[model samples]
Target: MSAAGIGELREGPLHAAVKDLLAVPGDRAEVRVEGFVIDLVRADGELVEIQTGGFSPLGRKLDALLDGNRMRIVFPVPAERRIIRIDDHGEVLSARRSPLKGSALDVFDRLVSFPSLIAHPNLVVEVLLCKEDHVRAPEAGRSRSGRRRRDPGERRLVEVLDSVTLDSPQACGALLPEALGAGAEAEGFTTRELAAALGVRMILAQRIAYCLRAMEVLEDAGRRGRAPLHRRA
Candidate 1:
């Protein structure tokens, strides 16, 4: 899917999740946070902010508010997206995790989802994971003599990526599938699998996965016997 198409896919699900989370007991009706105009509400007496895009100045403002009010920020952290810094007044409240590591968004999502998180009196941050599609090499077809022929769709995807600029790993991942002419149903490659296939380091492979996940092109199959596997709507 194109970037715009991916955004469209995220809209409904994200809105529903935010609405449901806000509707829980002790959760206040959705309201705009002062100054930033971000949609937010109080849940269990703690502020909950839903963020979708990057707004550094706005994040800084929210961090400042955390010093005075109990808050929990819920946002989608794009795969491989950098975490600049979170400063709560004079105290540094949070920092981005290591570069080229597993999804930062996934780590952030796990943190706030913990049962004990609601007990905290201070601010909390949660990131939701969204899967992305995969990019594959062009397919080869057999000729009359059993010779292989190149696929046009495969060439198209690569051409697209080569023609544009990519700002992040997520962007790279998103482009790759399209560039390589891999459709949505293409057998997706896992981080480990892709790493082994490409002869790259595990960290690099994971970063690529993170980007694809954030773009909603790949899906995570959660641990067995834990959470049920993620499914597309």
Candidate 2:
């Protein structure tokens, strides 16, 4: 469901910060269009949406808005994160740089929610690689892994490291590893090969393959044992 108004839309620090940075001088923020509240409507009539969460919730909103309008979905992936622990009184306890790194290809993880949307002529999926601070508050107990529990207090954007815009199926292909190649002369690759090439997990590679296949950028090239092979369509 669409938010009743801009004020009613719940956003964390990171999401709000990104929205403010993306807004242009001539753009209108929190605009109501066709019964949905658009994040930003440019002076030239382009719709911009900054989504810090999953894309599944945007399925209906995009379906309703994509017709006869240009829409850009801005998704931020934390290229680097600093973990900050906070005390009960909101005082900082400790801060450390997380070892995990994110890549532009991470967008495929979320794109799997609405893979076919990549084919829409009016839709542009913009992946913003950002450096961020992840603030956490201590929690009482931990049962699952017997580790200290922490709650997500806030996420603050530090800097926008880079951005990649997927405006067409070919643009989506750019997310694929260079080893994967493209066009009719392209070679087929399995999820294991994709994972190795991208330095990501097999699950993420699988999701990327799934999204690319749905976008028609990758087609079935037969199977390698239990795993499926994919090549450029």
Candidate 3:
């Protein structure tokens, strides 16, 4: 995929995931604070903001608003790799040990499954992903001092998996095909094309195809070499 295309792919899904998170029940409200549009959501009787982009500007604005009020901020995992935390002042408070587990769709599932969290009226949430150009940084000695390094084009499979919310085995068997279908269509790939398009190892694609078939979400279409096809039983 071209650089722009990769960005479009990530942004589209990231926005959907953010919308899913925001849909959690609570006194949900949005406001234009500073130069950023902030979504304020309540959880556990505490005010929180989901900070997506960066901390510099957001942290300063949030600190001013906090004014001694107990507050927390949540940011989406980096490419679904891991979640990071920030205080009202936008300082990096801590990094979550694990990425939000499950398939990308599972993230949405969790948000809906946990409706009680949305009932709170003081929380704010933000969701963001690192730009493709920032996906990897060069080693210190590899670049001039004070100059940020360019991102290598290598897409990190491990990081992507970490960032995703995987479904249970049964759920995976059930939902994998639909997710694959959506992914295929979004990427303009046919089933066979999709199996080839993952850019991951062929074995991984085959394994995912196998799981989908076992779930009855896919079936062999005569001898075309086990395409990433999906169909209802």
Q: Model 2 RMSD to the real structure?
A: 2.9
Give the top-scoring candidate (lDDT): 2
lDDT of 2 by residue, 39-143 (tens): 889999999888888889888888898987999999999999999988889899899999999988889888999898788889999999999999988665886
Tens-place lDDT per residue, model 3, 13-132, is 444345454456764444343443444535443445543434444445554554534444444544444334444564554544443332332222223222222222332332233322
TM-score of 3: 0.27
TM-score of each: 0.32, 0.91, 0.27
- Alpha-carbon deviation at 191 in model 3, angstroms: 48
lDDT of 1 at 125: 50
lDDT of 3 at 74: 48
- Which candidate, 2 or 3, has the higher lDDT? 2
lDDT value, residue 112 of candidate 3: 29
lDDT by candidate, in order shown:
0.42, 0.85, 0.40
